[model samples]
Target: MVQADACDGDADRMTIREAIREGLREEMQRDEYVMLYGQDERDGESFEVTAGLHDEFGDRRVRNTPISEAAQVGAAVGAAATGLRPVVELSFSDFIGVCFDQIMNQVGKTRYMFGGESEVPLVLRATEGGTLGAAAQHSGTVHTLVSHLPGIKVVAPATPAASKGLIKESVRSDDPVMFFENKAIYGERGEVRTGDRTVPLGEASVERAGDDVTVVATQRLFGEAMAVADDLAGTAELEVIDPRSLYPLDAETILDSVAKTGRLVVADESPMSYGFHAEVMARVIEDGFFSLDAPPQRVGVADTPVPFAPDLEAEVLPSAPDVERAVHRVL
Candidate 1:
């Protein structure tokens, strides 16, 4: 059930991190069964979003676990299957490696394996993507890897409003969800409702509507796409789409947009090969081939691991210029 409440409309002015904190706080308060726990360094992890949560929610509701990702996630799965909504905070998306067995073989496969006998209502929150000099070990956009797993949902929200709504929805979902939050978007602000206003699963929002090309993007790349759209407004018409949720993707919405524009471009910060951008392009080509006027285009990071150098990193990742060029080329 949606909370059906609204915020001051000032939430749009806050950062993504702030929005996440508010969402968690509100949800935990709204649902007595909701529990929060995860790995934290020194305290509530590197971002400090949950710094004081434990103090308010108490140890029973807000817990700080050991550095074992597998154990923590497994415990979350167990808790959820037993009738609690667990929010597992993964310190970083890369650390999911330590818990792959639990996530892929266990949490992701539980419901189906049990013949729908149980539902794992859990959200794995992690800081993902390149920025803030997090280096190779810490910086990674591994959503595609997780999105490939069955029985789990993957979502990336780039703005405050989306961050809040998406998290609320994920918490309420019966399926396990991997919620990727960009470290760079932590401080970005947007409007958010005070109560449960979910953005729903598998739906894409058209951030900017146009007729030339539909630039499907999400996360930080969504921002870049919008900027690129504005930059190229005088030259060509552009539509910016944010597929807020990756798994359970709303292919029809995207296809409808592309069908209207007769052109397509997918932009994502994840590496190009077999990544989110490529996946979206594949979807368009497979399901909406007749709607395209030109070949679908993609703008994303190179297929190599992220490097530490800022300049080299910029070259590897997608940018506004890159998205602009891809959209124009498709047009």
Candidate 2:
């Protein structure tokens, strides 16, 4: 679902990792107050997503932090409150629980509690979702958890272009943003707009246009839905929508699509019960109830932990076939 002409002639083909690094570099150059710090960030660690960043920005702006989630996030909150824009990398979204108190209480409530006098312009970056066989502990899509909190903005970019634009937008925002990068799509290549182009935080991307059904997906599932739409092309026209920003979700685009197709299939990697799919389904039913031609279907992981075993994990995780079936059910 990578856009062929994302920025017209002002675009380049880059992996999601490179696009993110480029975005970070641009932001750092654009604003002197913007800084990035986290575990092994100076060395770029295993993924090397921030490999050249430390070399360019040096130790002051890209220093490594101790292995403490609470401290990393708490420090980010403090840094943001004092006028610096800090982007803290948490390594894995699964480890967010260790610092949930800091995120839920401090990062989420500082502005409101201070009567809008204080601004925590922080960005919490983490790699999330499965498909690498990293097992349950390292591969959980927990954006839904952060989205439940009141003040934080949740973003899950599906393509390299989005990865670049959303990161820049998240860094510049005057509010705390939880930016979740799907671990599986870092190497995926796409055309990324150059210059100061930034995708707004609350807008959705219509990856594919169709007439029969609308498939709303997030993160990795967005690509999966696109593939299904391609395979089922001509047989069933499927409209694919990627809700790039999960919170401040572009529900209007989704409602409009549902109104056109009269069918919905929300596909996400999170658990099904009380998860993102449920939230989207609830919104559709609440606001676009009469537009439904059939009961909306949700495709997601089973109500359980992501299994360590490859086979069990495959069984629990929703796949392209699951999305296709859901689309067919509504059709």
Candidate 3:
């Protein structure tokens, strides 16, 4: 007779944001060189993610910087080059513009420019999208912009488990990683594995396996696609894939999945123009052209600024219904 494996879990479920914080805390504890800093409003408060980190890690490790995005990012780059793994938060992804010069011109290009002599091992963490109605100024998904640039890795984790794993990996990586987290999904709960679980960069995770159609989604859109997939299961067996890390996309997995399903639909929270969805769709056509049954479909935010109004904003963004409709269209 064999004893069944029984596992002890966290007494209370934690949100995706909480899981990320836990990963950060664990990593910081393991690595003395790891530190965190960010421009958070409400007196060093952003989205409650860093609420207690400063207290636990002390002022030196969790120092709150000025409003200068470029300067702050530049400092992180310098710090990383000198051996510090600084995790800098931009507060909102939309504000990345302020630090775009440093991000694109300095940190991202350092490793390549220096011939790998210097490594900018930094993590830029931000809460993106408009679920809380922060308006156009605050809510935007600029991962596509950063992903297009070389030397930088972009990742958007859709679940608590992935969030924890991806955050830990990003903090430990030698490359500069742009970690985008949705503000809306911060409080969303899911199970996260503990004790050295690592999700590698540029890998896609199959959220739901199927054979009729393939739905590639990221972030919140992934959850929507899953729901839509469940609803469409009786009619069309739907296979849902979430490219957890966007920059170094797992094209093999996506291509293989599309080959099996013969159809592809990308659900993204970002705009359609030059977004990750566009990139994935283009890749599918280039490599999986013969495998595709029809043209690839994308369900995403319209190529326009997010509206201030709640209804209009909702209408512009992708949803479960939109995914379901796209699936039907592809089928």
TM per candidate: 0.94, 0.97, 0.95
lDDT of 1 by residue, 271-322 (tens): 8888887788788889899998999888888878888888877777777888
**What is the full ranking by TM-score, best candidate first?**
2, 3, 1
Model 3 C-alpha lDDT per residue in residues 186-271, reported as the tens digit of each score = 88887775687778888888878889999988888888888988887788988888889998988889999998999999988988
Candidate 2 has what TM-score? 0.97
lDDT for model 1 comes to 0.83
> In candidate 2, what are the lDDT values of residues 27-82, reduced to their tens digit?
99999999987999998855788888999999899979999999999999999999
Off by over 4 Å in 3: 1-12, 41-44
Backbone clash pairs for candidate 1 read 7-194, 11-190, 12-190, 12-191, 14-189, 15-188
Off by over 4 Å in 1: 1-12
In model 3, pairs of residues that clash are none
Task: Sort every candidate by lDDT, greatest first.
Answer: 2, 3, 1
Q: Report backbone clashes per prediction.
A: 6, 0, 0
Best by lDDT: 2
CA displacement after TM-score superposition, residue 283 of candidate 1 (Å) = 1.9
Q: Give the 10-residue window scoring lowest on summed lDDT in candidate 1.
A: 1-10
Among these predictions, the greatest TM-score belongs to 2
